[model samples]
Target: MQRDALSLSQYIVYRNGVPAGARGGLRNMFHRAFGAATFAGFWRHWNPIFGYVLGRYIYSPLQRVVPRPLALILTFVVCGAVHDLVTMAVRGAPAFFFVPWFVLLGTGVVLGRAVGLDLSGRPWVARAAANLAYVLACLAITLAGECFIW
Candidate 1:
């Protein structure tokens, strides 16, 4: 990715500084990219300024008390709320999409983590299957939002 001029480092999610692709190791580049589809990864990775503040002050502390799934949901909720606040300042009307989008994203991240955890300690094929399922699940969430939430 960095070599191909296609890397989105901050947009990519990391746990303990390891890239999701490095951990998943999908031989196919397409699989690798989508397999790493995560809202927290995107929100926490993109833009160092907000990323550091969010990661250090908000997200990290939340994870201490909450499980990974709950932590992910809370993270997205906070993100959604922040986006809503920012948009509301301009329009001052209830948003129909922003909050729901983050909720859907929270769902995606929780489900993806669940699938990934289930595949842990399994063989390579299981890992690959988990990765595929996770990406498909994220895709489903985004598409479903466009159809129904929009």
Candidate 2:
């Protein structure tokens, strides 16, 4: 259970980090080519910066309280819950899709840790494997939920 939680948290952080990086890149592009204002660029990069700060100050501090996996799981569940609430309110989508995705993400983190996957060393392969695992796991979970879990 603990391990599961920790994995989830790690996955959440990673997912958020990717999009944040992309946003930051886009902002940088605009600033470089179009002479966008600092304030606008800052706003564009805010997500990544915010995620980094949260992981460093809040998430890291909280992680020490539990085993790595459990910590990840708890953090991810919270993140998933928040996403669900926001999506439901803002987009009127059912909150169910997040559950499976979070579960899959948690599983991926555990597997990666167990295998000692070095994402930085083998970027393309590592990302492909991780993402494939994530997608498959999520699909399976969602299918199960639709068939019986729910």
TM-score of each: 0.51, 0.54
- Candidate 2 lDDT score relative to the true structure: 0.51
* Stretches of candidate 2 exceeding 4 Å from the true structure: 1-50, 91-94, 119-126
In the range 1-150, model 1's lDDT, one tens digit per residue, is 221232435433332244445654233333433333443333333443444555555677788998867776777678778887888888988665456666776786666556654433556555556555654666576568769655
Query: In candidate 1, residue 15 scores what lDDT?
Result: 25
Question: What is the lDDT, from 0 to 100, of the residue 117 in candidate 2?
Answer: 50
- Displacement of residue 147 (Cα, Å) in model 1 is 8.7
lDDT of 2 by residue, 20-115 (tens): 345555444333322212222221233444444445554566789977777665555655666678889998867666755665656566656677
